[model samples]
Target: MNHRRVGRREVLAGLAGGGVAALAGCLGVGGSDTSPLADHPVAEGLADQPTQGPAVGDATATVVAFEDPSCVRCAAFHRDTVPRLRSELVDPGTVSYVLRPYPVVFEWGEAATRALWATYERDAAAFWGLLDHYFTDQDAFSSGNVLDLTEAWLTAETSVDAAAVREAAAADGFPAPVQRNLDVGEAADVTGTPTVFLFRDGEYRTSASGSVSYEFVTSALEL
Candidate 1:
C-alpha cells in the first residue's frame, strides 16, 4: 500500500537498481500500509463491469487481476498460471477471482477492452468464454478485421448479437471505462499488465505483476 505508483519503466528500474529485494519492497513486502481497494470511478453509462467471481463479501479471499486484453503477457499468464490459481485458490473455495480490464497499448487494447465489457453486458457467461477466445487467438482480433472477427467469435458463443459489440468498440466515448480503469490503476500504483492484488481476511496482503509464476501467487496467498 505504499501507493508510490511506479510506471513499467520504474518497475524495471527497481529490478536493475537493487535486484529482487527492491522489486519486493515495491510490491508491498513487509509493509504496514494496509488499505482497501479503491472504488473505481466511472463516468455515467460506464459503470464498473461485473467481476468474474463470487459476490465480494462472500469469499475467504479475493484475487483482483488487472490485465489488458491485447497484452501478450496477460495471455501468457492466463495460459500458464491461471489453471494453478484456479486449482489451488479458486476451485477450493479459498478465494474468488476478479478480472479487470486495464487498458494499455492503446492501438488495440482499448477497443478490445470495450468489446469485452459490451459482450459481458449482453451475456455474462459468454464473457469469460470470449476472453479465452481473445487471448488464445489474439492475432485474429488484432487484424484490420478485428470487429468482424470479434463479432463472429461472440456470435458463435451466445444468443446476443455481437454487432452491438462492434458499435461499442467504435463509439467516441468508448474509452470511459478504460480511462476509469487507468485511474484505478494509478490509485493502486499499478504500472503493468497482469497485476494482481491479494486480499485475505479483509486485509490487503500484496500485489504481483507481469507473467508471474504460480509460485508468486501461492506464496502471496500463504501470507
Candidate 2:
C-alpha cells in the first residue's frame, strides 16, 4: 500500500463549514485524478476486501457502494433503500454488490471503518449484522468513543474474538485494506460517501451520491 500524503483538511472536508453539503452531491468530480467514465476495466485490485467480501450473484453486472460507516446518509440508504435493492436487484440476479469503505465523513468515520475492518477480520460472516448494529445504534454515542463501543459490541453481539479485534485494530497493518478502498474510490473519481457506481456490459457507466430512492438506483442499474 503506497502511503500518499493526503492532507487532513481533505479528509476532514465532510465535517467542515458546509460539512455534508461539501460532499452531498459532488458526483464524478475529479478525485485526485480523472474519472474513467467509459470502457474501464473492472478494478481487479478491488475484487473484494479479504475481510468481508461483497455479496455475489449470477448477475453479469456490478454496483460498487462506497460508503462511510458513520455517515448519516449512508445509514438512511441502508435502512430504507438497500433492502429493496437486494430483493429487486441482487436476489433476482440483476447485479452483484460491493460494499467498499469510504471513511471521509465525520471524524469518527475512519476509525469506525478501521474497527469494522478489524471485526470483520475476526468473523467475516458477521459483516452485515455488524453494519445493522452500527446503523441502528448510530446515535447511541458519538464517534469519539467508537473503539470502546465497538469492543463491547464485538464481545456481546458476535462470535468474534473481541480481544483479537482490539489487537488487530491497534496494529500497524489495520488501515492497509481501508486505504486500498480509498485509493480505488479516488481512481474512480468518487468524492463523497454513499456514492453508487453502476458497471454493466464491461463498462463503468453512471454514479449518484447521497441517500437516493430505490427506484432511482434500480433504474440506473438498468434492471
Candidate models: Cα lDDT each: 0.66, 0.65
RMSD of each: 5.9, 4.1
- Candidate 1 Cα misplacement greater than 4 A, ranges: 1-33, 36-48, 175-177
Q: Which stretches of candidate 2 lie over 4 Å from their true place?
A: 1-11, 22-42, 50-57, 171-174
Q: Encode model 2's per-residue lDDT on 26-98: one tens digit a residue.
A: 3332122233423342264555563222344335567778887777778888888888877777767777777
On lDDT, the candidate that comes out on top is 1
State TM-scores per candidate: 0.77, 0.80
lDDT of model number 1: 0.66
For model 1, residues 107-210, the per-residue Cα lDDT tens digits are 46667778888888888788788888878988666636677777888787687778888899766545555555666677666766777777776567677766
Error of model 2, residue 19, in angstroms:
5.7
Candidate 2: RMSD to truth: 4.1
Per TM-score, the best of the predicted structures is 2
Q: Which ten residues in a row have the lowest lDDT in candidate 2?
A: 29-38
Model 2 C-alpha lDDT versus the unseen true structure: 0.65
